[model samples]
Target: MFKNIKNDLPASVVVFFVALPLCLGIALASGAPLFSGLIAGIIGGIVVGGLSGSKIGVSGPAAGLAAIVLTAIGALGGFENFLVAVVLGGIIQLIFGFLKAGIIGYYFPSSVIKGMLTGIGIIIILKQIPHFFGYDPDPEGDWAFFQVDGENTFSEILNTVNNISPGATLVAVMGLSILLLWDKVLSKKGKIFQLIQGPLVAVAVGIIFFVLTQNSSYLSISSDHLVSVPIPEDTASFFGQFSLPNFAAITNPDVWVTAFTIALVASLETLLCVEATDKLDPEKNVTPTNRELLAQGTGNIISGLIGGLPITQVIVRSSANIQSGGKSKLSTIFHGFLLLVSVILIPKLLNMIPLSVLAAILFIVGYKLAKPALFVQMYKLGWKQFVPFAVTVFGIIFTDLLVGICLGLVVGVFIILLKSYQNSHFLHMEDVSNGKHKIKMTLAEEVTFFNKGAILKELDSLPRDTYLEINLLKTRYLDPDIIEILDNFSVKAKERNIDIQLLSKRGVIENPSSFTEFFRTRPKSKLSLS
Candidate 1:
C-alpha cells in the first residue's frame, strides 16, 4: 500500500478536500450532529480502508442514506436509538459477508454498472450547480429529486440565478481555471505539480480570496459560502463532540427493522461501489467483495459506537480518489487521518475555504464520469446494452441511487429474457419424408426456464402428420420445465399423426419414452457439446 506513497499522498489530499464538505453536508441532511458525519468518514477511511482488499476504493458517509437516516432517527426515537440500529446493522453486514453474499455484485449487468457511474457523475454536476454559484439552499448529501428545502433539482438550478454571490462566483471561476490549467498544462511540466495537487491549490486560493474580500460588501464571501467543520475550543469540548450509543434500544423491534434496512442498503451500496471502483482503477484491480463487507461492517460498528452516521463504500469519493491518482489503500487511510486532524486542529481555517471552490473541483470529477463521449459509445453498442445504461442514468437523476440501479437491473433482465426467448431453439425445414413434412428443431445450449415459453410455442405449432426431429446435439444443462413441455408434446403427437425423433451424442432415439426421465437419468458426458 505504501509503495505508491508519492501518488497516494497527493491523491489522499485531494480526496480529503473533496470529502470534507460532503461529510458535513451529509450529516446536515441526515439531521444528525455535523460531527457524527466526520466520525463515519474517519472510520470509513482509516478502519475500512485498512481492512478492505480494494486497491483504490474509498469509503465514507454516503449521501444515498441521508433520507433513510433522517426517517430512521425520527422513527426509532432519537439519534442514540439510531446508533443501536447502526451497530446491529454492522453485525448483520458481517453475517452477510460470512454467507458469501458478495457474489450479488457480480450478477449486475455491465450496462447497469456503467449507467450507475455515469448517472452519479451527472448528479454530482447538477447538485453542485447551485453551490457553484454560492447558493447553498440544500446540503450536498440530498441526492433525491425532491429536496427538503421545497424544490426539485432543476428548480433549484433556476433559483441559483437569483441568489448567486458575486464573491463566491469569482473565486469559483478562478479555482476552476487553476484546476483546468494545472490538469491540462502545468501538471505535465514537472513532478512538483504532481506533488502539489490542483485541488489543494484551488482550496488555498479560495481561502485567500475569502480572507481578502471580506470587507467588500458586494464581492465578499460569507460564512454561509464556506466549509463548516465543528470548532472545538478546548480538549474537553473537543471530546464532547462524540456521542455514545444507547445500547438499551437494542431490544426495540423497530430498532431491529431499521438495523436490517441499514445493513441491506449499506451492503448493496458498498458492493456496487466496489464494482465501480474496480472499473475505474487504471490497473483494473478487482476488490474482494466479501472482504469489503467485513471491512464496512467493522467501520460501521466503530462509527456507531462513537455517534456516527451509517457507513458505506461511496462511489463519489472513490472515483475522486481514482481520478486524483490514488494507486493504493494508503490514500484512503491518509484522507481519514486528515479529516481527524484537520477537524481537531484547523477547523476554523477549514471553514474559511469556500464551498464554491470544492464545487469547482467536483465539477471536474462529474464531467470525467459523465463525459459526452460515453453516451455515443453506449449508443453504438445498440439498444440491448444502451437502454439499461440510459435508464440507469436517468433513473438516478430522477429518483435516487438505489431506485435508479433497480430500474436499470429490471430493464437489463427484460432484455436478457427477450434474447433468451429469441435464441431458445433453431428450426429448419428438412426434405419431406414419406408424404410428411420433415421439421428439424435444434435445441440451444443451456436452455433455462426463461426459454420454456418459446420452446412450448414452437412444439404446439407443429403441423399434423409432420415428421419432427428434436436435435440436442448442441444442448447441455437443459431445464426440467422445458423437458416436461417436450414430453407432453410427444404424447399429443400421436393424435395428430405426428412422428417424433430425438438426436444427441448418446445416439438417436425414436419416440423417446419420457423426456424428463431421459434428461434426469443421463450420465455426465465429457464429450464436447459445441
Candidate 2:
C-alpha cells in the first residue's frame, strides 16, 4: 500500500477535498448533527478502507442515504435511537457477508450499470451548475431530486441564473481554468505538476481569493458560499460532538425494522458502488464483494457506537481517487486521516475554502462520468443494449439512483425475453415436394419457456398438405413446455394433411406419432447433438 505514497498522497488530497463537503452536506440533509457526517467519513475512510478489498474505493456517508437517515432518526425518536439501528444494520450486513450475498451485485445488467455511471455523472453536473455560478441555495451534496430547499433540481439552475454572484463566478472560472490547464498541459510538463494536483491549487486559489476580497464590496465571497465545518471553542467542545447510541431503543420493533432497512440498502449501495468503482479503476482490479460487506458492517458498527451516520462505498469519491491517480488503499486511508486531523487541527482553514471552487472541481468529475461520446457508443451496441442504458440514464435523472436502476433492470429483462422469443426458431422454405409446401424449422440451442410462443406460432401456421421437417440437431436442451407444443402439433398434423419428419443425430423419424417418446429415448432433458 505504501509503494505508491507519492501517487496516493496527491490522490488522497483530492479525495479529501471531494469527501469534505459531501460529509457535511449529507449530514445536513439527514438532519443529524453536522459532526456525525465527519465521524462517518473518518470511520469509512480508515476502518472500512483498511478492511475493504477494493484498491480504489472510498467509503463515507452517502447522499443516497440522507433521506433514509432523516426518516430513521425521526422514526426511532432521536439521533441516539437511530444510532442503535445503524449498529444493528452493520451486524445484519455482516450476516449478509457470511452468506456471500455480495454476489447480488453481479446480477445487475451491464447496460444498467453503465447507465448508472452516466446518470450519476449527469446529476453531478446538473446539481453543481448553480454552485458553479455561486448560487448556493441549499447545503452541498443533496443528490435527491426533491431537496430540503424549496426548489427541485431544474428550478435550482434557473434560480442560479437570476442570482449569480459575480465574485464567486469569477473565482470558479479561474479555478476551472487552472484545473484544465494542469490536466492538459502543466501536468504533462513535469513531475512537479504530478506531485501537486490541480484541484489542490484551485482550492488554495479559492481560499486566497476569499481572504483577499473579504472587505471588497464588489468581489467578496461570504460564509454562505464556503465550506462549513463545526467550529469548536476548545478541545473539550470538539469531543462533545460525539453521541452514544441509546441501546435501550433496541427493544423497539421500529428500531429493528430500521436496522434491517439500513443493512439491506447500505449493502446494495456498497455492492453497486463496488462494481462501479472497479470499472473506474485504471488497473481493472476486481474487488472481493463479500469482504467489502464485512468491512462495511464493522465500520457501521463503530460509526453507530460513536454517533456517525451510516456508511457505504461512494462512487463519486472513488472515481475521484482513480481519476487523480490513486493506486492503492493508502489513498483511502490517508484521506480519512486528513478528515480527522483537519477537523481537529485546521477546520478554520478548511472553512476558508470556497464552495464555488469545489463546484469547479466537481464539474470536471461530472463531465468525465457522463461524456457525450458514451451515448453514441451505447447506441452503436444496438437497441437491445441501448434502450436499457438510455432508460437507466433518464430514470436516474428523473428519479433517484435505486429507482433508475430498477427501471433499467426491468427493461433489460423484457428485452432479453423478447429477443429469446424472436430467436427461438428459424423457419426456412426448401424446394416444394409434390406441390406441397416443404418447410424446415430449426430450433435454437437451450430452448426455454420463453421460446414457447414463437415455436407454437410457427407450428400452428403450417398449411394443409404441407411437408414439414423439424430439425433438432443444433438444440442442446429442450423445454418440456415446447415438447408439449410439438406433441399437440403432431395430432393436428393428421387433420391438416401435414406430413412430419423429425431430424436429429438420434436418426430420422418419418411422421413420428409422439414427439415426447422420440426425445426421451435420445437423452434426459438435453438433446444429444453429438
Candidate 3:
C-alpha cells in the first residue's frame, strides 16, 4: 500500500474533496446533526476501508438511506435513541456477514443494477441543479423526488431560478468550465493535470472567488451558500459535538424494530454498492461480499458510538474514487484521514468553498453514470432487458432507490414469465390429408403452470379425426399443473376423435389409459432426457 502512495495520495485528496460536502449534505437530508455525517465518513474510510476486502470500494453515509434514517430518527423519539438502533443494526450486519448472506447481492439483475446507477446519476444531476444555481435552502445531498423541505425536485429548480445568486452562479459556471476543461483538455495534456484533479482546481477557484467577491454587493456569495462544516471554536467544543448512544433504548421494542430495519436496509444497500463498485473498478477486482458486510457493520458500530449516521458502501463516492484513479484501499483509508484532519485543522478553510463548485464536480460524476450512450445501449438489448431497465430508472427518479429497484425486479420477473409462457412449447402443424390433421407439439426443457394456457389453447383448437403427438424429449422438469392440463386435455382429445401419442425418454405410450398414471408409473430415473 505504501508503494502506491504516489497514486493513492492524489486519489485520496480528490475523494476527500468529493466526500466533504456529501458528508454534510447527507446529514442534512437525514435530519441528523451535520457533524454525524462527517463522523460516519471518517469511520467508514478509516475503519471500514481498513478491514474491507475490496480494493476500490468506498464506504460512507449513503443518500439511499437518508429517508430511512429520517423516519427512524423521528420514530425512535430522539437522536440518542436512534444511535441505539444504529449500533444494534451494526450487530445484526455482523451476524449476517458471519452467515455468508452477502451472496444476495449476486441475485440482483444486471438490468436493475444498471438502472439503479443510471437513476442515481440522473437524480444527482437534477438535485444538484438548485445548488449549482445558488439556491441553498433545501440542503445539498437530498436527491429524492419529494424533498424533506416539502418541495419536489422540479419545484426546487424553479425556485432557484427565481432567487439566483450572482456570485454563486459565476463561481459555479467558472468551476464547471474549469472542471470540463481539466477533464477534456488539460488532464490529457500532462501528468500535472492528472495529479491535481479537476475538482480540487474547481474548489480552489471557488474559494478564491469567494474571498475576492466578499465585499461586492451583487457578487458576494452568502455564508449560507457555502460548504458548511461545523467549525469548532476549540478542542472542547469539537469534542462536545460528539454524542453518546443511549444503551437503555436497546430494551425498547421500537428500538429493536428500527435496528432490524436499518440492518436489513443498510446491508442491502451495501451489497448493491459492492456489486456496482466492482463493476466500476478498472482492475475488475471482485470484493468479498461477506467480508464487506463485516467491515461495514464494524464501521457502523463505531460511527454510532460517536454520534454518526449509519454507514454503507456508497456508490457515488466509490465511483468518484474510481474515476479519480483510486487503485487500492489505501486511497479509501487516506480519504478518511483527510476527513479527520480537515475537520480538525481546516474546518474554516473548508467552509470557504462554494457549494456550487461541488455541485459542478458532481454534475460530471452524474453525467458519467447516466450517459445517453448507456440508455441507447440498453435499448439495443431489446425490450426484455430495456423495459425493466427503463422502469427501474423511472422508478428511482420518481420515487427512491429501493422502490425503484423493487419495481424493476417486478418488471424483470414479468418479462421472464412472459418469455417462459411463449417458449413453453412449439406447435408444428403437419399437412392435412383425407380430412385429417397431424400436429406435433414439442415441450420445452421445463414446463410450468404458466405454460398451461398456451398449451390448452392449442389442444382445444385440434380438429376432429386429428392425429396428435406430444413430445417431451427435452423436458427435465414438468409442473404438476401442466401434467393435469395434459390429463384433462386427453378427455377433450377423445371427444374430438383425436388419436394421442405421448412420447418421453422412457418410451412411447399410445392411447394411454391415464396420462397421470403413465407419468406416476414411470420411475424417477426415466424422467431425465439425458
Regarding lDDT, does 1 or 3 come out ahead?
Answer: 1
lDDT of 3 by residue, 200-291 (tens): 88899999999999999999999888889998998899999999999988889999998898999999989988988888787899999999
lDDT of 2 at 269: 91
- Candidate 1 error regions (>4 Å): 517-530
Clashes of 1: 0
How much is 203 displaced in model 1, in angstroms? 0.6
lDDT of 1 by residue, 225-249 (tens): 8898999889999999999899998
Where does the lowest 10-residue lDDT sum fall in candidate 1? 521-530
Candidate 1, overall lDDT? 0.93
Per-candidate RMSD, Å = 2.3, 2.2, 2.2
Task: At residue 152, give the lDDT of candidate 2.
Answer: 83
The estimated TM-scores of all candidates read 0.97, 0.96, 0.96
Candidate 2 segments whose C-alpha is farther than 4 A from its true place: 504-508, 517-530
True-vs-predicted CA distance for residue 78, candidate 3, Å: 1.2
Count: clashes, candidate 2: 0
Question: What lDDT does model 2 reach?
Answer: 0.92
Give the candidates in order of lDDT, highest first: 1, 2, 3
Clash pairs for candidate 3 = none
Residue range 8-49, candidate 2, lDDT tens digits? 999999999999999999999899999999999999999999
